[model samples]
Target: MEMQVWASLFGVILGGLLSYLAQFTTVRLAARNEEKRQAAQRAEARRSERLELLREFIAITQAGIRIAEERDQAPDWDAAGTPEWFAAARNIIDRLWVAERMIEVLFSPQMYQLARAYASAVDHVLWRLPEQIAAEGSMWDHLRGPQHEFLAGARTDVGSLP
Candidate 1:
């Protein structure tokens, strides 16, 4: 009877230890999975934010390019200095300044540099419009290289996200 009691006690103890280990492992795995899920959510949120920022910045840049193109095509250089023209140009520059600052804050150093170059190219063209000096080609040509470089950099930056 004593032997029977000892054997039963050993079996019960071993079973309880195994049950505890299983529960511990399950809880750890669940916690790890939760952490991974939350990390993925955060990454996705960041990617979305970057995409919106790029979209807004690109739209503003295009608007600036259009204004520069119109100025380039204008026949009357005197009209370029009108208050209305200055107001429009000022508005574009203000928006571009904001966009540039946002890019500088949110993006990598290389991305910010690329954005700055593109913005500067556009600004140069706009400022040159009032002088009536024709470049060898369209003023938009000045923006093409910097725009392409910035776009490529943006694509790379966005695509690298998880």
Candidate 2:
């Protein structure tokens, strides 16, 4: 009877120890999985935000290009300070400003440098041709390569359109 009691106690202690170990392992795995899941979620959120910013930046750049094109094609655009001409000029400037700010806010440092280079190209054209319009053909040509590289690197759907 004493031997039987000893055997039962041994079995009970072993069972308790096994149960505790199993529970501990399960809790540890669960915590690890939760951490991994949260990390993935944060990475996804950052990717989404970056995509949105890229879209906005590209859209603003496109708008600025279109405005410049329209101004180039306009008749009597040489008549500086005329209401219509002034409005187009203002629109182009405003859109470029917005693009610059977008790059500043959304771009990584290296990306910002590349984008700023593009913007600087545009600025140079604008400064040189303050009163002229279609003269920016060279500027657009210069931007095409860098713009394509930027878009490709970013993996964004925004295309580099002249």
Candidate 3:
């Protein structure tokens, strides 16, 4: 009878230990799942932010291209140095600088380099307008190559995101 009581007590302790282990393992698995879900959410948020930044950069670059085109086609080169022209050019450049910095921070080195090339092309066309006009030459042709390359790189970069 005494041996039976001892066996029952041992069984109760063993059962409680097994129950505790099961609960512990379940809690750990739940925590791991929560972490995985949060990580996915963070990744998605980052992708969205990157896409928005890319869009803003593209728009600013397009604005610069339009300005360059306008300067190229203008009959009066004298207007290139006007305050209005300066303000417009400066605004684009300022925006480009901000976008470029953000790209550098958020993108790969190759992407940042592509952005730099495009920004440089825009800068060349905008700042060299007077010289090009005086020489009866156009940098509009030069801007197109860099613009195309940057756009292609950007598209590829975005497409490759998972």
Q: Which one wins on TM-score?
A: 3
- Ranking by lDDT, best first? 1, 3, 2
Q: What are the Cα lDDT values of the candidates?
A: 0.87, 0.65, 0.86
Off by over 4 Å in 2: 80-107, 123-137, 156-162
Model 2 over residues 1-162: C-alpha lDDT tens digits?
999999999999999999999999999999999999999898778667767777766776665555555555556545533676557656766766676677667656667776666665555544446444344455578568767776665554223211
Segments in model 3 whose C-alpha atoms lie over 4 Å from true places: 130-140
Write the candidate numbers in order of decreasing TM-score.
3, 1, 2
> Could you give candidate 3's per-residue lDDT for residues 1-162 as a string of tens digits?
999999999999999999999999999999999999999999889899999999999999889878877877777876656788789989999999899999999999999999999999888777774666558465757777888888899899899875
Error of 1 at 6 (Å): 2.4
Q: In model 3, what is the error at residue 34, expressed in angstroms?
A: 1.1
Would you give me the overall lDDT of model 1?
Answer: 0.87
